[model samples]
Target: MVHDQYMSLSLVNINITSYCMQFIDSLCYILVILGLVGNILGLLIFSSSRHTSKISSVYVYLATSSSIINIFCVIRYALVLHSKTRIIINNLIGHVWFACKLYELSFCFRLISSWIILFWMFERVTCVSKRLRTLFYRWNASQLKFIIPCIIIFIILGCVIGPPAYMYQPRISKNKLSNSTIKSMNYFCGLPSTVSIKWQKYFNELHLGLNHYTIRCFFSELFPAGTIIIFNSYIMYYLFRTSYQFSQINENKITKERQRTTSWMNIVLILHSCLFLSSLFSHVVGHFLSVEAHETWWVLLTVLGNCSLNFYVYCLSGKAFRKQIIHIIQRLIILISYKLQTCKQQQQNHQYDNFKIENLIYQSNHVENINQPKSYGTKNYPKTIGINSSSPISEQETSV
Candidate 1:
């Protein structure tokens, strides 16, 4: 009886795990599709002709970085799905050098995406702060063009520290079967081999606790999160202060514009702060708990949220962004409607041409029947033969 109960419990656990895995996989797939769509729409909206001013450059950078991060999320989720399948594809991707490098680069992109938002907030803070306005007064179109290269360089420099801290390699383990021993391999992205050895040695020798994961997490995740929060808070404070100043002054178009911009930035800052905090919490929890099943879902949800939140914020907050999005949607609808109409017209023309051809063929066949000579049996032979000696029989018969 106890054995049966144990078996039943085991089966129930298996079913639950399967259900959870399926749900997580479905969620990840949906999030990946949404992230791609949202980020692409953001890129299109930000890169438009109307948003070419230096003021919009921060948004342009944010959009570009977010798109790249979305791509990385897609890849990461795909790998997770592959890994869950426990197939050869996962082995190839996980153990291969180039694949490992790509994975590392994804981390770099994630960091870059986070820091880019911080930079954007910094720009906002500077724009709002009276003391900092003069420092950035020279910022122009030419200066804005260099932001992309600077971001690239920043990401590269940040990623340079990753290789020594972590490495990807296949781990081998032995399992004892009923009759024999079996060896299996799994890939891990963790501490470098040397670091792992040193970590053990240091703990054994000096009883000290310092390791690679802690270092990587601190630099890549916590530091960026802290910086973003700090800058975002400053931006908010300065924006409020600036708004108060604007209210005290006499009304002018430029001052009104500045107030509007500050308001927009405040809305964006609030949304980003919420997104960043949620993502950071999930990331930190996943790292510490190491609960693969639940942690994966949490991490993916946070990533999807982070990737898509900005687009929604822009649409909700920025009048220009909303207008551009609507314009793009309208144009797309018009383009699709035009193509559909063209196809329908072409189909109708094709049908009409077919009908005309059919009619022509029918007429040609009727004419052929009329022109053909008709022969009758002996009863009608006299009529058939009496038609005409010189004229065609068919024409004579028709005349008769």
Candidate 2:
């Protein structure tokens, strides 16, 4: 009976795998299309001239770079995912290990760029404090000195995580040889045998750093994401309570509406917090899973999924962005429709002008025929009809 139960589960797993393999290509195609559209639109709208304020500049700049980096990241995983599925996955000149290294390097660049965006947001929040902002300005001689700090932070981050990118590789697990073992392994590769044992401690350090990063993510996110929700949510509640304290304030619907909108914005910020938290968790999971037994499926899933959550957050929670997207689409539609209508009008006008020219030509010919009599047989004939001055009765109603 136990064996029969096991056989049933195995059959189910195989059926699911077959189903996933069939549609995985379509899913990838859709993902690419969506990434292209959303990222391009995100870049364009976020990086507008009107949004170049001190308040939004950081967000816009980070959003632009994130979108671009995500596009590249998608392309990288696409090859790895396809190769694992054996669906036309290209090899690095028939060498699988080289492909693994290239994929890892591309992914590292993508991830580092995203983390930099988060750090950029931290800089923005710092600038919002009046005292710190003033001090920052005084400490520097140049007007654009704020950017220098961000440049320094990115440099530090690159130094810390840049080396492990090339060192990490994906390899299939031996446990996967038995169907009763783990469902998936990490998208991990075995290190090349050419490296010496002297670098063994470095791997140990890298593993330790990976653990520390998880803890760091948890603490970093808890304050900004969790405390933020609790504090802001209550502040809004208190504001609501105060509004009802006076009838005059309550009577002002416009003020109440503004307060309501602002309150909703706080809600959105909470939603944004949740999204980032979820993504942070995904990163934590992806790290461990990829390290233990690097399954290609989970690897691509985590990377792409974590990157994609932001796009949905912006579209769903950001009222301003939603409005901007709608406005842009409306303007584009109007522009296209107006152009088409104008072209149709021009074509009709052209036909009318040609018709007028033809009428004018016909009229001119008619007028010329009357104005100049033809010299038929050299006979002198009046163009107009003449009546005889002296009329006499003739036998045949004719005159000589």
Candidate 3:
């Protein structure tokens, strides 16, 4: 009876794990598609004439970069997380150098994108703060220089840490007793174990303590989360202040409309930061704690979810983004209707041409029958009956 209980418990655990894996797979697949389409549309909209007139050119550049990098982030999720894609990618980039470089690229894109977004939030905050308005205006003209240098710095940081974090190459281990080989590349480029025990211990200590715990948890995860909280707090405070001012100045329609637009823009920024923080918190917790396989999967899903949510959040909160979306839809509908009309006209013309050809064919056949000699009781009649019939009349007239 005890053994039976254990067996049942094991089966239940297996079933739960299976369900969790399926759920993760489905969610990743959905987010990847959504991210790709959303980012592409975002790129187009940011470059649109309407948006360029309303938003600062500097902000547009930042937004364009964010959308572009977010695309890479989604791709990294597909290559690293999704099972089928991971297998194909692994087979293609199974070598140590390629795998490490891929990881490094993922790290760089993710880190750079996040920092770009953070700076963007700061830029928004400056616009909302009355005292900083002048500063914001000045920065607008020269912000590209600042942004470029920061990106270069972040790229250097990522390059330093990303490649070294995963030092070991993948291996295929065989169990002679079981006569089987383990073919899973899940641990590809993970920690090294074939070295000496002393070196392995050192490697584990350095990798887990410095790279995983200190640098990743504190800098990559916590620092960004902290900044997001700070930035969002300032934004929310400004919004409340604006509402209060609007209440006091009841007759200022311009101020009220400005407030509404500011709120709309910041709301998108706040929501994006909130989602990012949630994913960061989850990642940090998962790093320090012992989590089940399903729990780890859930954490990973949240990370990708944050990457995928930006375009949607903007659509929901930014009036400009929605307007751009509507415009795009309208243009597509017009184009499609135009294409359909052309196709119908072409088909009609083809049918008319066929009809005309058929009529000509029928007329030729009728004329051919009239001209052909007729057989009447073994006698062949002359061709061109009309001419022959007319010849007798003309000859009678001449004889007269």
Candidate 4:
């Protein structure tokens, strides 16, 4: 009875795991598609000549950040999908080294994406604080030049830290058959674990404790979150203080407009940072806490949802972003309507031409019939139309 109950519980666990995995797979697929499109649109909006003209040139940082998020989303989803399938696992286990490297690459992308956001927030802060601008004016002017080098530097940093952060280990467990000394080994790609027992102590101390708990939790997440919050608070204070002074004096249209734009930009940045922080916390909870498989899956879905929802957040938060989206939609609608009208016109023209050709062919055939000679039993007669009379045919009558 106990054995049967144990078997049933094991089966239940298996079913739950399968369901959770399927749910994760579906969500990841959705997130991957959304993240690709959203981030691409973000890049276009941030990089557009007209959009950038109105806003600070620092927005280029956002475009770069979107690009990084796109890569991170793709890599993260690929890893999730890879883990869910036995076929993929079997294939990947054969090349464990490559799989490990791919995992490391994904970690690097995620890290880089977060750090890029932090850098962008720093630039925003510099733009808001006059004192910082004095110090960072040249820095802001040369930001375009630094974007590439900054990305390269971050990539190198990620690569250096990524390898130690996570270690992939393929496990082979031996199972002994009943009444037999022989044991069969089952090889499978398993969860991330220490590379070997010999290095377990060092791995836990350095990689898990120092690298993950300290660097990842703090610098990648906590420090950035705190800094962004502080920066945005300072910006809000500066904006309100300036606006109060402007009200006390004569209203300047140019300064007011700039303030409004900055306010809208701040809204977007704040909301984006919130989503990022939420995802970061979700990641920590899902991985570090002892939770059910389905719960972990839900947590991950939330993380990916953050990656996919940034464009929507921008649309909701920023007036300029919303306007750009509206403009693009309007342009697309007009283009589609024009193309449809053109197609309709072309079809109508085709039909009219066909009618004209058919009419000409009918007229030509009638004329040929009129010119041809006709035989009537014992007498030859001419075929005529619009006249009902039996008359002998003449050359003039036939010609007429």
In TM-score terms, which candidate is top? 3
What local lDDT does model 2 show for residue 98? 67
lDDT of 1: 0.59
The C-alpha stretches of model 1 lying farther than 4 A from their native spots are 1-19, 52-62, 78-89, 94-97, 130-133, 137-167, 177-196, 199-210, 246-268, 291-296, 375-400
Q: Write the per-residue lDDT of candidate 3 for residues 358-386, one digit (tens) a residue.
A: 99999999999999998755355454344
Mind sharing the TM-score for model 2? 0.58
lDDT of 2 by residue, 216-303 (tens): 3333333334544444455455456555554354567777766676667557556656655565555455445433222235545544
The runs of at least 3 residues in candidate 2 whose Cα sits more than 4 Å from the true structure, single-residue gaps closed, are 1-17, 20-30, 52-59, 78-90, 93-101, 123-128, 138-161, 164-190, 198-251, 286-299, 315-319, 334-400
Estimate TM-scores for all models. 0.71, 0.58, 0.72, 0.65
Question: Would you list the clashing residue pairs of candidate 1?
Answer: none
Over the full model, what C-alpha lDDT does candidate 3 score relative to the true structure?
0.63
Note each model's CA RMSD in angstroms: 8.4, 11.4, 8.2, 9.3
Global fold similarity of model 4 (TM-score): 0.65
Ranking by TM-score: 3, 1, 4, 2
Candidate 2, residue 186: the lDDT equals 30
User: lDDT per prediction?
Assistant: 0.59, 0.53, 0.63, 0.59
Candidate that beats the other on lDDT, 3 or 4, i.e. the better one: 3
Between candidates 2 and 3, the one scoring higher on lDDT is 3
lDDT of 2 at 168: 45
